[model samples]
Target: MDVQPGPEREDSHVDSDVSASTPLRVALLGAGVVGGAVARHLTERADDMAARVGAPLALVGIAVRRPGRDRSDLGVDPSLVTTDAEQLVTRADLVVEVIGGIEPARSLILRAMEHGASVVTANKALLAEDGPRLYAAAAEHRVDLYYEAAVAGAIPLLRPLRESLAGDEVRKVLGIVNGTTNYVLDKMDTSGAGFEDAVEQAQALGYAEADPTADVEGFDAAAKAAILASLAFHTRVSGSDVHREGITDVTPADVAAAREMDCVVKLLSICERTDAGVSVRVHPAMIPRSHPLAGVRDAFNAVFVEADAAGQLMFYGRGAGGEPTASAVLGDLVAVARHRVGGGLGPGESSYADLPILPMGDAQTRYYVSLDVADRSGVLAKVAAAFAEHNVSIETVRQRMVPDERDGDRHDVGEATGNSNARANLVIVTHAAPDAALSATVESLRTLDVVRGVNSVMRVEGS
Candidate 1:
């Protein structure tokens, strides 16, 4: 696996003496995919890791719920497996946590830090929810708490934002942070598959879970957005602060409409600095094919960051899977191990800016709205009036009659225009408007007698 190390060190703490430095005792929690891979890689690269850190890295023990479950496949020593996770964490100089969730993982990490063990974790949900308290605990104990795997899998994102771009002002962070949603959307774009069919395909391919609520409902990406926004803006943003919209509501019509405008529908986790404050949101939006993010397909991930000094930078790679995610875990493990050997701490939390999260209502973006309405003269004027009423300025409006076969379900009110007894598809693309105003316009359109239904409404993003 290709794993990129963090920024280089200025301290010349390199020691080549094999027997001089004390071996760092490493404890691993969770013998699942990431943890097992970390152990295997640690064992395979023990010699190399010892040389790099100036001390031998020993896997003292692995904490697991089922110690009896055969882990011989991972090459883990059976004697190292233990059920007492608390005891296991206390005996180590450094702990690598891959077990997800908020409870035992959080408590165990805090306890490990108190025992003078620097920690590396890949738990994004926990970090987004209770990061401040963990940071404070690590600071109090003078132990490092590094979590490079919490976002973007193996992309090496957090360190660059925390270190390399520390001097630059990061203006925006836009990413396709969820792999499941990306796969589903890619199917919808390429195969012309509906939401259910695309999701089924993703499941069959093992890209999504049986219960894909976290990925499909946008919760996963929203949590990642919170982490990204906090790092980019130096704010303590949580998942609840982000405005989330899932692809569950996306229809085939939405996908076809994107094609009409030379765009593709993607679920994006976006974080930006606004004049009011910081705005973070996750939603399905249309991006032009020419945009860098549009080409990111399948389970792949990409993040576009715009900084004042550095201009624009794009980080692209495989964002998920156990190996890719384990790669990130290993990177953090190595960095934290080096810091432990040097008796120093890595970068702690830097939420000094403390910017407030802006409300979604105030967020401004363009919109694409498609409506099925009666093919009549006054109907177009009435629909145009709806936009004007909500203070939404329209950039373009195209009206066309639906084919007779497609219009079978649509009822024709009367004959007013040349295409007498046919229902029309009204496509309206708006300029940048407040989210609240665009939402209001859509609601008002539904109330109009001429409009049968609002087929699709998607935000338009990117250049």
Candidate 2:
């Protein structure tokens, strides 16, 4: 709703009077929650959109598998609905794609571009996977491809990185981009609930889906991370390029451990321009409670961007749902339509930098490791030696007697710590190191005679 008209290309062949009178045809794919809202928006605000775009924007057709289903509630005529998406795309001057996924959506968009129609889509998964192909098609056909709704929904995130901050040098992008995971993690942090309980609460509140594998398992967030990384770093970052770790492994013990260190666990999508090239990852990491991202709770999304000129900028708002996501789709639709009437195209993919995506092994981040070790003199020395062997530096060490803690399940390992029969929970916080070396250090600790068990190991971030 706060979207401003982006600058059109300098070159224009169409006269202002001629372009203003020309009506642009719009075709929609998928009439789900987002699509239904988009239909209502176009029908209800036809006069407003036409005035904004300097030309009349007409809804020519709506593509749907089930045409008989009543869309009267959305003010869309039953006749506008058609099952043939291929035919619908070819006829329209502009295509607004809210239908998600890879197959039909991708094919239809390419077909639309081939027909010389500009496109606006909200499909992050498709963009992360085969964006370069789509970009190439749009460039070859000389049509615009705008996907402002792809990354952070209606938050106006991708546009700022791609356009607003185009002149600035972006160094890093850290975000809580997934609303479902954010709600689940926020519930766990505040209510002290286990991962399952928090996720159940999220589902009950309509924040998460019945099958939350995509959200909880971090696949959705990873896709968004790839898109963000590609835009911010000017690299061809795909979903496979990101190092993903789901929130499923995040336990109550890990949450409590974060409390002891004045931190909170959050599933963070991080992209950084490193000396090695670029690093992008999505994982549940511990951030200090005072951090800006830690305060983003419930089904709310926030992205913290760092640039050389801008310093640091934070964009916070709703990242999903029908209306919010539709607002973004509508924004792109308006921009592309204006471009059609005015002549010239919006910004295409900017991967000229073509930075290489660094592997997870080279990524550097702090670690919060909880180990069940013998509560004896030389135990710390042996553990310190293990870290030193891998060249990982230690920041802090906290030793907790199992008897002092309220949680009883932690000290179940008995008679394992030699003749002492006492196990101490050694919570070791490490300085930044390569992820591969940190994981190797944890593995080496497991083999140590002093350690009874490796309870948990989570990455620490945000200082």
Candidate 3:
């Protein structure tokens, strides 16, 4: 397979060896797709890499869960493979960790820094959960720790935040970072495929995993949002800090309703700095079809950034997969290598701005609420009164009559009381309001006798 480098790869320059100096050796943790790709890239471009780094760069070791498995395709010698991940970190000048999760990846990264080795990783979950702690360790040891691949894969988001746009004050970062969920939602809209069928298609095409809860339920996007919020605001935000809602609740009716409003449904991870504090949320939302994010379809990603100086800027591309992810890893490796050879390091400790994370109830956004209500004389009036009670202004209201059953089953008032098919679908789009007010309005509507059921409630974005 051909190896493709990232945007920063062209700037890589290997240095000449000093009289007493040795080549910079790198150990890779995890032999998965990303790990293997990093190894392959390093070996394939060893000559160019050496020249770029101002010293020879060698792949010294690899750590894998199953050490006995054949990894010859990675282009690394079998002797370099090891099952003991902790031991591998000590022998190299730098460690690139792709193994995910919180336990060993965390421990190994800390240990590598303690041993005076620079570290690069693509583990978003680990970083999102405990970034401050890891950065503290790197600061204490004076070692470089970079994670550009954590958010939008192949998109140079992290470096842009840490370096390129450091002079500017970033106000908001709204991104579609999870490609699997995007793919599923796109299929649902374009092909009219249900959730299950779209997910199955994604799995078959390697766009989704067998256990896709992390993707579908917004866990993955939440993690990315936490990372983005931290970098953009120069604060510490964890996975627990983000309020996440998934795409599981989206239905065909919801899709059609969005289309009627000239909107498209997308899983959005939004991070913003407010007077109250930093707000982070991940949820399926409706974006106007004219918005740039609306054009992002299938398994692709895009991050829309709003800053003081730059105004609105967007970074778009493939966000996942081996080659795309590997491209990011290699880009970081080259930069880290150059910094090491020049005896210089990038930004040190993150000067946390001490921003508080606002609760989800305080988040402000518009909502699309679908209600099944009894088609009676005062049902709409009662519902409108309930919304007014909570101070929520309705932007648009769409009502569709439910068709009567073709069969000879009697449709009584009792049967139509709470049945969605027995009542008219009342779709209401609300103006931007406090989440608490929206919740109060929804609660009030649920208690009304004329309200049959709430089919769906989704946030509207890019309005």
Best by lDDT: 2
| TM-score (C-alpha, index-matched) for candidate 1 | 0.92
- Kindly list the per-residue Cα lDDT of model 3 for residues 104-157, writing each as its tens digit: 999999888877788999999998888889999987877789988887889888
Better of 1 and 2 by lDDT: 2
- Sorting all predicted structures by TM-score, with the top scorer first, yields 2, 1, 3
Q: Write the per-residue lDDT of candidate 1 for residues 1-463, one digit (tens) a residue.
A: 2112222223322221224256777889998988988888888787888787777777888899897788987675687888899977776777899989998999999988877788999999999889999999989888889888888898989899988999999999999999999999999999988899989998998889899999999999999999999888889999899999999998887888898899999999999997789999999999999999999999999999999999999988888778898899888887877777665777888999988788998888899998988776688779889999989999998865575444454433344434544677889999999899999999999999888888889999997
Q: What are the TM-scores, per candidate, against the unseen true structure?
A: 0.92, 0.93, 0.91
Residue 32's lDDT in candidate 1: 91
Q: What overall lDDT goes with each candidate model?
A: 0.85, 0.87, 0.85
Better of 2 and 3 by lDDT: 2
* lDDT of each residue in 1-463, candidate 2, tens digit only: 1112222323322232226866777889999999999988888888899899988777878898888787777786677789999977877778999889999999999998888789999999999899999999999988999998887878999999999999998999999999999988888878888889988988898888999999999999999999999989888999999999899988888888888889999999999997779999999999999999989989999999999999999999999999999999999999988888877788998999998888999999889999988766677789999999999999998777676243343343332334466667888999999999999999999999989899999999997
RMSD, one per candidate, in order? 5.2, 4.9, 5.4
Once model 3 is optimally superposed onto the true structure by TM-score, how far is the C-alpha of residue 127 displaced, in angstroms?
Answer: 0.5
